[model samples]
Target: MNRSDATLFSGGHKGAEAEFGKLAEKFGINEVNFTFEGHDIERKVGLKILSPDELKKGDVSMDIVSARMGRNFSKVDTIRKVIQSIFHMVNSGYQVFVVGWILPDNTVKGGTGWGVELARLFNRPVFVYEQDRKAWFSWIDNTWVEVTPIISHKTFAGTGTRNLSEDAKNALEALFERSFSES
Candidate 1:
């Protein structure tokens, strides 16, 4: 069997979770391993099912880590933990996909979103697919950024010129073609 691991990074608190679920279906991933805090009663009971160390290791073989969101980003240690987790997953040979969802209109406060920022800082390729283009662009600023699932002509600076919706399919096709031709 041919299999490659992929990690999907998203905010744990909001729409990103739903987006992650959809992406999982698109990517054919059934269950994804993630860290869940046990602050709540239900979560605590669930956490009891496995040891903390085992949880850190992962629930199953080849199941790379997935982060939904972070509570705080001010501390360097918190950011480092996330980076370290991601680095470990990638080192395990999983392709990282950073997904960012739009924040609510009133809560557009800066600083809350860091999953994509951490991914970029670590020089990982980001696969950005969002519901609202304008809002997402406002969050990630497209001036000099390159993201996957390229859905907009304004964001498609690659070889082909096509509608944004076709960008993801086109890009994947190009990659397969290049790889096959090279071999």
Candidate 2:
């Protein structure tokens, strides 16, 4: 597959999202970072600033979000917009890649977890790189199964915690290497 033909969907925040954007650039892959007004992003490449109407298309009640992830999120405009934009990322990407820790409750940690939960809800192919375990896990049959995942879809998502780890960074490099090599 021509790497340039592939597009990465991400938030373009620091840590995993920014790293993913960098890797996407290194691999000659296109990237689109979704955001709304007043949102601060570390990487500015391919930013698609969603209009209020556009952002509203992905909006959902925080109560529903909390119920799905088994945790309560702060009720705030910024966080709401973040969640709404994440819905767009997952909706646009057929496959999703994330870097973060998966809690025992099966939900991923933090706001990144919302993306994972959205992926699951949308039935998108989602992979999570656990920094603590130094391993990758894929969502399969309602469970997170350890596996070696690659960038299979031409359009996929890369998201995770802002607090990235060295191993996670290396893991992403390996992922790009493994993907383009096999391609």
Candidate 3:
């Protein structure tokens, strides 16, 4: 199979890479890059990336944006830099997979969270913590949705290294496959 042009926009943690690795293997994906973890004030701010379809959906990719920018622009100026990077990816025809880690407490707020909201705002598919199995789910919904009752195995175990509980793995695989497959 030909290598797919894909990038995993992770929250930046240890276990998250496991899942990313699995995704890479499943689809022969290229490029696994992490998002920014610092809150610098000198970065530019705006929508991260713009998809070709975005011209019709009026959506923008915020996959590389800083969530803190919405709250910390008062102190940090890194928003534009983050957003611009995201824009560069989208405009360049690369599909960005926004990933969020599931917290042990059944929450999506920890470990560099961004996927759901970013996907929603950008009108792109998202991979999030599977509420029941600790695996990740693709957000194909029109609006942002968060899963509850987080599973531990999928969230803590990096992808490709362990069993991903059939359902969870399937969901993630389907999203990635469908995104790049030509109809």
Candidate 4:
């Protein structure tokens, strides 16, 4: 049986967790690993940004991580940690997917935004589930192009759509295969 591993990137906010949970439920939990900063509580699988000593030094919970990520753009340390975690995941051959809200100002939340940017910079396959549009979009030529057929918000809210065209799925599978073979 052919299988693929994925890394999910989210904004790490209140609603974000629910979105991620819905996504995980939709796409079999075993198929993807969620990454938010250095925490992966469910799968217990992720890149380590802080050593045991660092974690032991102070309060380093998901709440703190979430707060730090909220200010990631201005916090060099937080930004660096987030970038490094993303780099590690990409380098380890995990397909990246994003799910979050796009703000009124046309900007995504910090960590999610950074993950999308990193995927673009590294030429990795990145898909974003637009909650409002109820469509899956991909970054192409510096813009978001819808990649899947339009679906209802209920469908989007339910088993998160993974029904890309056969050609698109094949292309993504090939990318994952190549990464695995290379590794």
lDDT, residue 147, candidate 3: 38
- Estimate, for each residue in 52-93, the C-alpha lDDT of model 1 and write its tens digit: 454455322121222233233334433334333333333332
C-alpha positional error of residue 21 in candidate 2 after TM-score superposition, expressed in Å: 0.3
Rate residue 88 of model 2 by lDDT.
93
Candidate 1: lDDT over CA atoms?
0.31
| Residue range 28-95, candidate 4, lDDT tens digits | 32222323444534333222344533433332344444453454344455544544444444444334
Quantify all predictions' global Cα lDDT against the true fold: 0.31, 0.94, 0.38, 0.42
- Whose lDDT is greatest here? 2
Model 1: residue 87 alpha-carbon error in angstroms: 7.2
TM-score of each: 0.37, 0.98, 0.38, 0.47
Q: Who is ahead in lDDT, 1 or 2?
A: 2
Q: What is the C-alpha RMSD of each candidate to the true structure, in Å?
A: 11.9, 1.0, 10.9, 10.8
How many clashes does each candidate structure show, in the order listed? 4, 0, 17, 0
Q: Where is model 4 poorest over a 10-residue stretch in terms of lDDT?
A: 151-160
Worst 10 residues of 2 by lDDT: 174-183
- lDDT per residue for candidate 2 within 8-40, as digits (tens), equals 999999999999999999888999999988899
Residue-wise C-alpha lDDT for candidate 3, range 60-99, written one tens digit per residue: 3343333422322212334343333333333332223434
Residue 132 lDDT in model 3? Answer: 54
Supply candidate 1's per-residue lDDT for 123.
56
* TM-score sort, best first: 2, 4, 3, 1
Please give the distance, in angstroms, between residue 61's alpha carbon in candidate 4 and its true position after superposition.
23
